[model samples]
Target chain A: MDSGTESASADAWDGEIETEIGHDEYDPYGTLTLIGIYFVIIALLWVFMYFVEFLGEGPTVM
Target chain B: MEIHRYETIWFAASLLLIVGFIGTITYGAVGVGVEMVDDSGGTVDPDNLGSHERFGDTGVHKVNESHYEVNMIAVHPSFIPSEIEIPAGSTVTFYMTASDVTHGFKLVDSNLNTMIIPGQVSEITAEFDEPGEYGFVCHEYCGSLHHEMAGNLSVVPEDEWGGVDS
Candidate 1:
């Protein structure tokens, strides 16, 4: 283990490169999934609030 | 600039969401008949409310069948005729004005809400569908006792409704 004796370099790193994904190929499936879930939740809440809560509570100004 | 496919989809989705929101609001305004409070209630001299025709005698006025009118004044920490009783299935128009400063009137559990401004009458009309007890509060911060500035609205059955006190 040549700890500090070896100068820090890209080649000196212990990790091995597996596969590289380019910007075009890198599809953020996790982020897209999360955002989709959030959109669904927000849409559901909006429908419930506007239709069920507000519209249902009548005696509104006509 | 080149955009990612997911980013483009998200952008389009966002635009659709915005349009959907506007569409919902339009539907509420046009189809559902939800109206915003406007200056249609006409203006009034806050100082001379005492001698004014309607405000001179503030209370509920029966306007023949299925219609009623309420003349109310909002003072520092109380509404004149704080407890208002009306019949169910009747349309009531409220004409309100503030003598001192600006105050807010928001009826709990109903869509009747407006700001009472000095020298200007805040008028709003609402229908009483069911018989129930509803509370109204001054939402605006007026004075030290603003928290206690509240009132009650009583919607009684048609048969139980006693005509306005002469």
Candidate 2:
């Protein structure tokens, strides 16, 4: 059962590469975009936690 | 080292993020005046907590017009003088210690949080500018009724603030 699905999926990419792309021409913009989004999320969370949960909590230690 | 432009950008961004993180914490400490519970409370003998000067008489004491000191003791499943009452617009310094085991003291909705070890003391000071009620709990699990280990802190209006009710 596993061999049939494996071979069928493997055959789809069995063809040779039509064009070769070198490292200098490749750009991982997608990874950059993903990391940028993650950074924004983390920064937002830090602001909320620090400003709202911590500072806005009131009666903080002096 | 030869690095790609994208890698360089990512590296610079990462450095900025780290610096921003440190700057935020510094601002909190310096600008906002956030403090940590330290060894200022000093040490005590767990077995002789009853003989301690402050811990011996666990309750609220008025230092001056704007300052107050609260001496508290934490046992297995309860806090001595659990119902703490104080006046609003006052600064309070909580002196807490545990007699049996280690416990945590965390005032809900406030930054008044610390740990109470058997032989060690935890001291934290905070300013209550508004009149409100805060619930404090033992964040550490000590025994069977650890969840039930909680207390109430009432910051009443200055005019309505009566001395500690014996």
Candidate 3:
């Protein structure tokens, strides 16, 4: 079964000018990846410390 | 066979790991400790940066004793809200959510340090025992203007509030 509105919307075409100006030169992937890795490590350490906080000892940053 | 620059890469990685560890613990302290989550068990709202609203009227809010709510939206790079006004010597709950990336929310009066995740909300409740000018910061790494994400909260005397400014 096909709804009239849905089918009409799919077929309707009005050529629209793209308003977005794309940035093709910038690549932040590597930076983001590095940052992501950094936080993951810290989160693991915090989990380790949360349990330890109760014992009155947080891990030293050596 | 040509192998070169490997040492530099290793050095960088090591440095990055060390820095990351220090940062993460700070994050866990502010984010994990509070069990900071929203009504749906998810801290982030998938659409907006952190306001829990995907678009339009984005950002966190606060509720006063008289039940006056203020919405903090689109904080600029300076990390400071352009303006904040609250009744003096009153308890105002701050609800913060980032509209883009991660931002740190802290209050000078309360020393609140919390990481607000994009698409998630981080909430903090603070009481201004005395009326005064208070400033805040975004501690998390957000962007080129990370250092600039700052805002302020003002505490005014109860009488200062409009009589019906509930």
> Which prediction has the highest DockQ against the true structure?
2
lDDT of 1 by residue, B58-157 (tens): 9999888999999999998999979999999999999999888999999988777799999888888888989999999999999999999999999999
What value does DockQ give for candidate 3? 0.01
Q: Candidate 3 residues B1-166, lDDT tens each?
A: 4333444455676687777666765655664443333433246553544433422442223343544344444444754244677776554544555556666666554445566665555544444556677776777666788676677766667777543222
Question: Candidate 1, clashing residue pairs?
Answer: none
Q: Which ten residues in a row have the lowest lDDT in candidate 1 chain A?
A: A1-10
The TM-score of chain B in candidate 3 is 0.57
| Model 2 lDDT tens row, B19-89 | 98899889999999998778987899999988888888899998989999999999989999799999999
lDDT of 3 at B137: 74
Which candidate number has the best TM-score?
Answer: 1
Model 1, C-alpha of B147: deviation from truth (Å) = 2.1
Listed in order, each prediction's TM-score against the native is 0.89, 0.88, 0.45
- Ranked by lDDT from best down, the candidates are 2, 1, 3
Worst 10 residues of 2 chain B by lDDT: B1-10
TM-score of chain B of 1: 0.96
Question: How well is each residue in A1-62 modelled by candidate 3, as lDDT tens digits?
Answer: 46988878877865686664445434456766776688677767755755455223321111
